[model samples]
Target: MGVTYRRILLKLSGEALMGELSYGVDPAVVHGIAEEVAELVNEGIEVAIVVGGGNIFRGMMGAAAGMERATADYIGMIATVMNAMTLQDALERIGIPTRVQTAIAMQEVAEPYIRRRAIRHLEKGRVVVFGAGSGNPFFTTDTTASLRAAEINAEVLFKATKVDGVYDSDPKKNPDAKRFKSLTYSHVLQQDLKVMDSTAIALCKDNDIPIIVFDLSVRGNIKRAVAGESIGTIVGGFCEVC
Candidate 1:
């Protein structure tokens, strides 16, 4: 079947790349993700990804450890670039055309981010992977994903996570916590649900972009999400059918 959304920006946390490991990227995990993304591209869906670096280094953690805030954030950005490069390599190995665009200029590794160029890349059917978290300090990759999704005019933002969907309480902690099939941006912010940062949620709300929080651990979840299967929490807009 055809996908419901034409173009989508997938937000992947660095921790998602670590499969059965405490930290660091697992080659097999990266390859699996690449395979999923490749399937989307083959189905004629334009795909872009914004990856986080929490598994390698978290800026907030470093700041708490007495490091300079800006310096620590920069380090975190660099770590994201590394993850992006690793993902790019994996996608290319499987014969998927991909490009790594960094917010911070890294001429030797990837191209510097350019808005028009990124849109053009997607038009040409290349999966553009954005790295470096907006090239600024004090901003999380969640915000970067939101910003990029808007800039690229993506139809939806897929926030991949371990949980199947957003719950009133942590499902791991509260077995009775109800999962939301669909929610409004106002509800998420008012309840302080940890689906995405406030900034990211607000951005998507303003842009009228729908955010789907789904379980990435499931093998075919990505495809299901792109296909508009009701397998996760849909935020920003409510649909009776969803």
Candidate 2:
């Protein structure tokens, strides 16, 4: 089968790394994900990932308790580094050459954020995992995924979340929440749907890259998304205008 995406950016939430256990990285869960990613590599798709830090450090939680926002965000960034390292270890164990690039400049552990080097890694078929949420406070990892996708010139941004697609309401909390098979960014914005933070959708719209929202829990979903089967809500592209 022909590869649908030459290159794709996957946004994995830190919560995705948590498996059966309550907190932290679950090795089995991560290894399973790495194996699935390896299959995509074997299929010749260039993959870069941006992972969230909510599983380890919820900056919003700290801020809600009246802590300084910037300091809490820095802690959150460090949490992402920890998650990236764990995922890097799992990927390497399975023979995938992966690089963890952090925006916060942790030179001893991983490469600092450099767009040229990152693009070069993708060209060379290495998985570049971006961590640290754009190295700025008040920016969510969703926005980071869009930024990195644009910087790397990836064709699409694949956001992996607990939900299968953007819904009219929280499916977990609302039994009657309707799942959107597809959605345009304009409709998402006009209706004030929580598909993503406004900043993320705006960046993708400006850059002309689409975002695919899918449930990461479903087995082989990532591969399916990269292979161009309509697995989730597609936003911010030509089809959206159509």
Candidate 3:
């Protein structure tokens, strides 16, 4: 089968790494994800990843509880580094050459974020895992994913979340909630559908990067998405999901 996106950026929430655990990364879950990613690599798809930090710490939660916002965000960025390292380890264990690049500059552990170098890595078929949420206090990992996808010239962005797709209401709370098979970025922003933050959605809208929102819990879903299968909601594109 032909690959739909030759180069794509995957946005993995820290919560996605939690799996059945209440907190932190799950080795089995991560390994399974790596194996699936390896299949994409075998199919000649270039992958870059941007991981979130909510599983360990959320900056907004700290800010809500009286901590300084910037400090809390910095701590949250560090949490993403830990998650990225864990993912890198899993990918490498399975023979996928991976690099963890942090925006905040922890040179001893990982490489500093350099746009050209990142693109070169992708061109060489190495999976580049981006961490630290754009090295800014206010930006979310969603925005980071958009930014990186644009920088790397990625054709699409895959948002792997706990939910299968963007729903009209909370799926868990409301079983009658309808899942959107496809969405436009403008509609997502205007309707406040929560596919991503407004900033994230706006960036993709401006750059023309399609964001695929899918459930990470489903096995082999990553490869399916790469093969252009309709396993989730496709934002900024047309085509109903099966």
Q: Per-residue alpha-carbon lDDT of model 3 for 1-242, expressed as tens digits?
A: 66788999999999999898998888899998899888888778999999999999999999999999999999999999999999999999989999999999999999999999999998888999999989999889999999999999999999999888899899999989999989888789888888989999999999999999999999988888888998889999763432
Tens-digit lDDT string for candidate 2 (1-242): 45788899999999999976788888888998999898988778899999999889988898999999898998998999899888888888889899999999899999999999999998888899998989999888889999999999999999898888888888889999877777777888888788779989989989988889998989999988887898878886443323
List the lowest-lDDT window of 10 residues for candidate 1: 233-242
Query: Candidate 2's error at 72, in angstroms?
Result: 0.4
Model 3 scores worst on lDDT over the 10 consecutive residues at: 233-242
lDDT of 1 by residue, 54-110 (tens): 889999999999999999999999999999999999999999889999999999999
lDDT of each: 0.94, 0.88, 0.92
Name the lDDT value of residue 156 in candidate 3. 95
> In model 1, which regions exceed 4 Å deviation?
239-242
RMSD of each: 1.7, 1.7, 1.9
Q: What residue runs in model 2 are displaced by over 4 Å at the alpha carbon? A: 237-242
Query: How much is the lDDT of residue 33 in candidate 2?
Result: 91
Better of 2 and 3 by lDDT: 3
Candidate 3, residue 139: the lDDT equals 89
Q: What is the lDDT of candidate 2?
A: 0.88
> Top lDDT: which candidate number?
1
